[model samples]
Target: MNFKELHNQKTPLLLGNVWDVPSAKTAEKLGFQAIGTSSSAIAALLGYQDGEQMGFSELIYFVKQIVTNTNLPLSVDLESGYSRDPIIIAEHIKELVALGVVGINIEDSIVKDERILLNGEKFASTLIDVINVLSKENIDVFINVRTDTFLLKHSDVIEETKKRIKLYENAGANGIFTPCIENESDIREIVNCTSLPINVMCMPNLPDFNTLSSLGVQRISMGNFLFDTMYSQLERITKDIIDQRSFQSIF
Candidate 1:
């Protein structure tokens, strides 16, 4: 399905990011309309670190597996296209489309200091190049370009964020993502600046549900929250069982 069309629907698409085939199948079975692959989840599953630690072949393999397992639309987090070279990244996008992903989330962030680092102009330029390549294919693959301004600890959040949104939109991104914009006004400002759907992360400081829905957010993603939660809960439960103690407290 086209990402923009999906966004135009009355209810925003809620995507659950999965790490493997079983999880994807289970999510589809549970009636989720679409499923996304979390980069961090995939990295943890492969016993490698995130942020390009896994290569293109590995990513395509995983995407192919997920596609084989489920009928739902799959959106992959192809972190920075796993290469800085724009041409290579564009070619990789074509390959990912071949693997049957309906959408992709490419970020403007490089990994450093235990967090995402923004490379706004470079990332946007590569994305524009990738879009041109996809155009030649005559295919409509959703390119949800992610910006890390809100996610990072940086100044000039507004100007920097505006620069990214405008650049990527001009670059032909199907949608935009700002991972952790906690303040309502900040979120509102972003929504106002771009006509493309704004996808936000569901975190602890998430805006009130009613308020967010009123703000014109077209999509919401759980990102790596599900995997982290599962890991944390499993650890707690097993530790309690091993210690002959009952698991207590609701998550």
Candidate 2:
């Protein structure tokens, strides 16, 4: 199934975010209709922190590996498109599309000493340029515009999110992703405010698939949770082996 049809499923599309070829293969083997990359996960795997610390060449190579091995549609989490210039961002996206990427998540947050969101109007302008470039190049990539209002805990989050969603939709975003939004009322409000597919990240307080589906969510992404959990388990197993001086932990 195509990425668009995956969103239109009876149940919300669940993307098992993978950071490497092994993880991508595992998710695909487990019957995930599509696979997504977590920026933080990819960064950590490459011995860097999140926020585009991994070089673009390294990232593209990693993505090419997954695309080469997996049959599922892949959506990459390109944090802020790896550049401030919209034309450069579009070029980066074109490269990914050439590597068989079907979708991408581009956020509006700027990562500096402190995380700050870009101005809504300015972000929308950049998004329009990126969309225009993609259209000109004849690349039909799904642009998932992610807003950081809830992630950054902005005071007027609901209002600001709604406003940005409207702007981004007009800017040609195929979907809206609001990570860290757990409130039912807020989710409902955002869902009601836009016709675009809603993509929510998995968080501790976020509702389950059934609850989210009822809230009109179309896509549910695990983000970096799986990678974090896998490493956490690995840490536990290693500590167990060191303390007990036995191979029982492997069993």
Candidate 3:
């Protein structure tokens, strides 16, 4: 099935999030249905801070490498589109589409030293403009709109998410990604409110796969958790090697 169809399956699509070629290869090797780039992880690997601090050209180059190396349907986490201008964002997305990207996760948040939620109504307007531009250019790609209400710890995440998802749905979003939302009831509330596929990210408190599936989630993402865990293990092992003062661990 295509990337968009994957979101509609009875079993929620489990997306392996990768930052580089090896990670992408490993996900494909292990049989992940699809994979997505974690923009923050990619930025860190390139020695840049998260958000859109990494240049668009740099992102295109890195994403092209993954696209070239992997066969699995690939989605890119395009944080805030790297620009507020809808035209420029659409153009950036076009670059990804040309690189064979099947879908993308674009969030409604910006980074000014830290991530902050954007005005929902305005972001929806931005989405409309983006959709219009893409349609005019005949560019088709799954646009998963990420709302940061839960991510930012909004006072009322469930209600705020419902409000934003409706706006996004009307704006032609293909999916809704609510990161950092873990409570089963909250997940059910959001899922029940939106016709668009509801995507939930991996969090420490997140429910198990079956529970998420039962709650009506359509997509489950790892965000940067896998990359974070792998590297955290690497750091620990390297530290252990130093403490032991031997290369025994290498074998």
C-alpha lDDT of candidate 1 relative to the true structure: 0.84
lDDT of 1 by residue, 166-237 (tens): 999998988999998878888889999999999998889888667777888888898898899999988877
Stretches of model 3 off by over 4 angstroms after superposition: none
Estimate every model's Cα lDDT from 0 to 1: 0.84, 0.93, 0.92
Per-residue C-alpha lDDT of model 3 across residues 46-151, encoded as one tens digit per residue: 8888889899898888899999999999999999999999999999999999999989889999999788999999999999999999999899899999999998
lDDT of 2 at 114: 73
User: Deviation in angstroms for 43 in model 1?
Assistant: 0.2
In candidate 3, how many Å is residue 48 off? 2.0
Single out the weakest 10-residue window by summed lDDT for candidate 3: 224-233
Clashing pairs in 2: none
Name model 2 segments beyond 4 Å from true.
Answer: none
RMSD of 1: 2.6
